[model samples]
Target: MNRLNLFAPDVRENPYPFYATLRRESPVCQVDPNGMWVVTRYDDIVAALKNTQVFSSAGLRVASEPPHLQRHNPLSDSLILADPPRHSQLRNLIGRAFTATTVASLETRMRSTAARLADEMLQRRVVDFVPDFAHRAQANALVQLLGLDPSLQPNFQRWTTDILSVAAISPDDERRMQDVRRSIDEMEQYMNDLLASRRRQPGDDLVSGLLRSRVNDCALTDEDLMGFLFLLFVAGLETAVTLMTHMALILARLPGWMDRLRKELDLIPHFIEEVLRFEPPVHATMRLTLADTELSGVRLPAHAVVALLVGSALRDEAKFQDPDLFEPARRAQASLAFGHGAHACIGAFLARAQARVVLEELLSRCRRVELRAERLDWNVSLNTRCPLALPIEVIPA
Candidate 1:
């Protein structure tokens, strides 16, 4: 059989069919050329996520680093690259700022923001839902939640996109790395200033919260503070933006589902889950084998990179009945969308709340949302699954 070229344009357009074929033929197949094993079956992917010891996030980071960046190993100790105890410590320190109460309280504000954005879109008639609605709302919500200055919104957005772009392709490109380094330097300087100001006079924001957090009986160091800030700015904004954009595009395409959702507005939560399953914003997550491991009887050497095709796992027929079909009503079951085990998204609750508020407001306020363009363009990134543009006409209620 021919090798599966996931990067091929045809595969990117609609990869489910190929994924199904891979699951059937070789659930754990190695793309020898890339030195990466691709896991397609749902069960194996779940196992890999849960079994962090064997399939480590450290390997994932190294795999993600571009060939040029691999030499310097710039991200040697980032939270996402760490394993076990250290990962737990760092994650816990940052996770404190995103507690349930903290996120829940933001719902009212998020709802207000979503409604205001949707109302404005209605006034415009034709709207690019991605940038105007999804991107703006997600970015604004995150900025407010993190307590960053509103003036930094545009710069933050640009830096977030550039960082993710670097991750998606050409991790080692010197010019791009230089640009990223410059952005990081600026972000660090801004954050350090903010941290110092917060130290003098504390405020109700994430940076302040971090300043208050203690690890190993000591206040967070500058490296810890800056690293956490960097992680939050990129992951918090990019994932939420992509998820919102994908949700909008999917609803626009599947009018029947959209109509049903409009009628049953309370089902927005379930609908979001289905969207995560059907067209997840995070297509794949990379992992490395910390120790020699066997997956589905295939022997993998220690340090071997493995790319878990999360999109494929979500639609794995063996796990979910009629996986391809969008069924939000399925009995409340767990999915790997937010991931599983320890490294699961700390901001999952916040993301869901934000998405729910956006969809709820859109459905309640808009009478009809019709697609204005023939083809929707998707952002070409390996990790993030989102559309570049989703043009639609919003008819007010």
Candidate 2:
């Protein structure tokens, strides 16, 4: 099989080699006869993400318009998938919850939660960072931020994972598709019930905040509300968890850096940013061309699927001085990990805050954290880049 087909399994284990080939040879190469142009250069990807008029986010999933997406109509008119006026309005409404002050307020809680979880995991000697530490921290943070019942945290995580897996599985994978469809229905029902409850007894949370916001003298419709909530649950939690796992894995590899961080705990923020660039939680983002456009001299047809390899872009030698090296003290440059332009991650501040807290707490408590296993079991999905299980041994401080 060719290098592109390697993405199916081998790349999932470690995609850096294939990603390097894509970046070096054909920054805009078509993969596996799919005709989906993979754009790896930093400039090209950023340009595409910024120019929403030419390269739209709409019809992102339907690169080939699968029968399931067409038949079931699973792609909701969510802000992430929508273009223009609708995307702007929805983003504005949801933007309120992620303001600087709002995100800052959650720091104490995030730190305390992280410390407690780390302490508990330390007692056990061996723990899967994904479920025990990363997932717990992310899910709990979302529950507090979104004002959802804490009991539904696991359910929400499961639902979000299934939803993301849709892009990876074959369209003919009936069982997987049905599983995702069922999960979506369950999530919708859960969100509807939560919304109804909030209507009766409002609280000071993201959901309640959205309930109070007005978009052009109109309240958020049920579909809009559910879609926004779904987006938050997926984007808000998943990325953070993935970043946390990546941080832990990197720290294990670079023990000296971990030791330095443990001493100068204040540098945790910079360290997190470096981790984000060196090993981003998200590898790529897909965009559909709204009109025929020339990107990096390659003319793309209308509605063409352009997969911007964000992981490669972050490592582009042209952008950073030592792109591949993880240097926390180096002046931070713009990273495509959280994306750029108008579609930049609304929860960027919140994600940073959470990561800082987690890293600080881990470094402060644990004297040394080492990889207990030889290889990482990474999660393979079209969008999310994360480890399925990260086993680490936390030596006491």
**Among these predicted structures, which one has the highest TM-score?**
2
RMSD of 1: 2.5
Write one digit per residue (lDDT tens) for candidate 2, span 122-218: 8997888889999999888887887778888768677887777666668788888888878877877778888999899988777887888775686
lDDT at 369, model 2: 77
Clashing pairs in 2: none
TM-scores for the candidates: 0.92, 0.93
As a TM-score, model 1 comes out at 0.92
Give one digit per residue, the lDDT tens place, for model 1 in 1-397: 8788776667777889999998888888776436468898888988898898888886666543566543322334457676787788888777766587887877888888898999899889899987888878877887777777888877877777655655544544678777766665677677778778888998787678878887668665677676667776777787788789878777767777767888777677888988888887678888888888877887878887788888999998877899988788984344577777887877778778888889888888876678888765566665666667888988777
User: Model 1 lDDT vs. the true structure?
Assistant: 0.76
- Each model's C-alpha lDDT? 0.76, 0.78
